[model samples]
Target chain A: MNKVMLLVDDDDSLSKFIKICVEESGALMEVKQVTSVDKAMDYLQNKGEFADKSRNPDPYVMLLDLGLPKTSGIDFLKRLKNKKEYAGMPVVILTAMESTENIRNAYCNYANSCLIKPFGFEKTKELMKSVTTYWGRYNRLPDRAD
Target chain B: MDKDNPLVLLVEDNDGHAQLVALGMRDSGIDHELIRVSDGTQALEFLHKKGKYESSQQPRPGLILLDLRLPKMDGLEVLKEVKSDELLKDIPVVVLTTSEAEKDIAKAYEFHANSYLVKPMHFDELSSMLQETGFYWLACNKRAY
Candidate 1:
């Protein structure tokens, strides 16, 4: 089965654009967009709307937004780092914020990597290609037997 | 070291800044394909080939241009994951954000990020920085993969 990618962001429109950018690469990418921190956690935790495999499978990777409402992205990172079970899951922060404080704080919490949001679909297209190529192999996840 | 296929991965959330980075790379004629992600979570999803990114469109990146500040996970989380993973650890991850904080830089190095770059806010300065970044990372540097 193909791996899943969860995109959690409050910006509804940007979410759509991100999906298109990944798809435009034609890499068999399945982009899932959630609007809030709670919803994103649900997707990762396999609760709520994310429980269904067809509708929302376990993401091989997650693109998280930092400034999420309800549960802040930083808080979410802390939770993941705190839990050994989910620590192996590679989580990259992608957001509009570019603050030194956030960067330092994220590393202190043991985040995998921090990224600012990209500009356009064209550039995004390129980013998708690179991300897919490398990230796909970084984690040696268990191959779910069909 | 100047291979175009190994592409650059730019993980930035700001649309305007992202454009400048792309343009800067373009101006330098690095001729490398760039993949940009908005947040750290997205960056990880893309790197791990999970979530919406099961299949891959291009080859692995030669360099990663990462932004320190991100929405969900932030850059440090992303960096730790990349460095910890045996398969992806060797791949260069360059932190590119606007933080001049010493702690941020020190922590990034501690996580084993390949490099750190503070993004210039000014358009002209940013452009020059991008060009230099492209030249250094894409051209001058010796790439392992």
Candidate 2:
């Protein structure tokens, strides 16, 4: 079965690029894109429009962007990690900021991994390939009840 | 060396498994230096720079590949201690073990392990997994320190 990935990022172009790269990587993964942390939470909880389990399956991994409108990615990470139900979820932070403090904060908040948003087409493609191959294909997740 | 090529500390008691991991990393062609410790106690000692490691000049490892079962101490105990330590918590600790029990997976994540990966039974699959693991953590994943 193809694994579901929740991508929370406001950047339309980058999100589209990542979606394309991940799909093209041949990893069995379906990327669900959301612009805000609230939308991501909704998706995860199967609330509102995401009520259809078939359409919105539980994501095995989440690619979180540090920058968001109100609830920042770091803040979202803290919230998610605080929930024991979301303990097994792997949240990988994708950000353009190379700030040491931001990176430290993300990991300190229990982010599974952090990767700089790559520049240009080739680098992004390579990154997506590695991301999908590693997280989607190889990394194992705890069993989640449907 | 450089941030892109950080040292990897592998904590495993099995000699054969450790050798396979080294070979797999070599096959991946990613520049890395792997230091091995046989048990969970030594793993913590190396991380905290305790006892024999007190005078060691090795820089803080960028990644830690931990095994669940070990002599002296268990992997989960080591994981809990590392994640609890402010200085060590930031480092990515990926649990690499043979057990795929649901309890183990859930527990590792509960301890805030960076990731959990089951060691493949076949030699070829193990090699492939190590390559992907090494490539992703060492090359693709960015570190703060």
Candidate 3:
């Protein structure tokens, strides 16, 4: 079965591109896109409109964009890592930031991996392939129930 | 393994297994120096730069390849220590071990291991895994430093 991927990015076009890439890479079954950290948290917590657990099964992996409109990805990461139940979820920072400080900050906050957004379509696709192969296929993720 | 290459600290007690890992990494497209430690204690010592490794020339490793069933301290213990420590926690630790036990898998993730892989029986499979690992973790994945 294809795994679910939760994508939190403010850019609609980029998120759509990532969804296509992840599906084409044959790693994930579906992509749930949320524009802000609040929405992402609502989805994860199964709150409000995201109340149906069956429809919103926990994501196997999360691709977070750092430069969100509100509640930046770094702060969201810190919050997620602090929550006992959500702490085990693997978070991969998918951002355009190539700065050393941002990279170090993400890692220090316990991001499982960080991927700088590739400039070209093919490069982005290739990155998605690597992400899927390693995280989706090889890496042993925590049990979904956990 | 070239000295100038990024260092990969490998913790495995079995000599034959360690050699196989070295061989696998040798063919992995990314080049890196492989530092071998037999037991969990040695692994910690090497990472902490304590014990005999106090004057270690190698800087902190960019990545760690750890085995579960080890002597002295065990892989899970080593993983917990590394993940909890402020300085060493950022370095990715991939649990490379033989056991496919569900318990081991769960425990490794609980401690925040970057990834986990059950060693394949075939040499070719091992080599393939090493390639993928090196390609992703070394080539694609961003480092904190």
Candidate 4:
């Protein structure tokens, strides 16, 4: 089955470049970009209009950005880890926040992985390629229920 | 064994992650033969030779690259299983995932996961990490046959 990769970054340029590179890599990722944490939840849980799996298939992996409007990445992680039902859901913190403190806190909250977002487009593309290569194709993620 | 092949089992769900890891391993030039399996269930199957893996496949994977959050079974569960089984317990299982959750980290050690790696997203960084990881596991550490 084909896989879905979800990203919640407000940066349009970064997201576009990442999407293009990811597609070009031939990994078969259906990239979903949401601007906010609420939308992220909506997409992941298939809430509201996203209920249609055809449009919003539950992602095999989630690359979450730390900074967001209203709710922060840490807050989202707090909520996500708190829920026992979604334990199988592995969250990768893919954000620009690259601090040891942030890394410590994010890990404290039970995030599956924390990735410091790359700065340059080329660097970002390389990061995206490697991350997907390891987790998506090489490593086996948790299986889907459906 | 590919004459000089070192067995490594990788349990990760994402395809992109797998590709980059492959590249990194190649860059490191370790000549480690990698085995890919998705989720915890298949991991168990591979270790035990159940289901599609039915035994008699030469030497077992020398090391395991385990992702913490897996479907059907989580990494912790699989770790516990690997550690518990006397036949497979001796082999090393490395917990390599993106999460740095305190509880998860603590729990991984508690379960006796051999090593833990929080994956770097950038390719260069990841390559370096793979170089280190591959070297440490394949070269530095001694394993039982």
- Tens-digit lDDT track of model 3 for A62-90: 99999998699999999988776775578
The candidates' interface RMSDs, in order, read: 13.3, 2.0, 3.1, 12.2
Clashing pairs in 2: none
Q: What digit string (tens of lDDT, one per residue) describes model 3 on residues B100-128?
A: 88788878877888778888999888888
| Tens digit per residue, CA lDDT, model 2, B9-126 | 9999999999998899878778888999999999999998998999999999999999999999999999999999999899999999999999999999999999999989999999
Residue-pair clash count for candidate 4:
38
Worst 10 residues of 2 chain B by lDDT: B1-10
For residue A28, model 3's alpha carbon misses the true position, in angstroms, by 4.8
Q: Put down candidate 4 lDDT per residue, B1-145, tens digits, no spaces.
A: 0125678899988899987877776666667788888899999998888889985484688779899888899999999898767677656777889887867766775565555678887888888778756654564333444
| CAPRI docking class of candidate 4 | incorrect
| Evaluation by lDDT, superior candidate among 1 and 4 | 4
Specify the poorest-scoring 10-residue window by lDDT in model 1 chain A: A137-146
Can you give the lDDT of residue A69 in candidate 2? 96
The 0-to-1 C-alpha lDDT of every candidate, in the order given, reads 0.70, 0.90, 0.84, 0.72
Q: Which consecutive 10 residues in model 4 chain A have the weakest lDDT in total?
A: A135-144
Give the Å error, residue A57, model 1.
2.2
TM-score of 1: 0.51
Q: Per-candidate DockQ versus the true complex?
A: 0.03, 0.72, 0.52, 0.05
Tell me how far the alpha carbon of residue B84 in candidate 1 is from the true structure, in angstroms, after superposition: 12
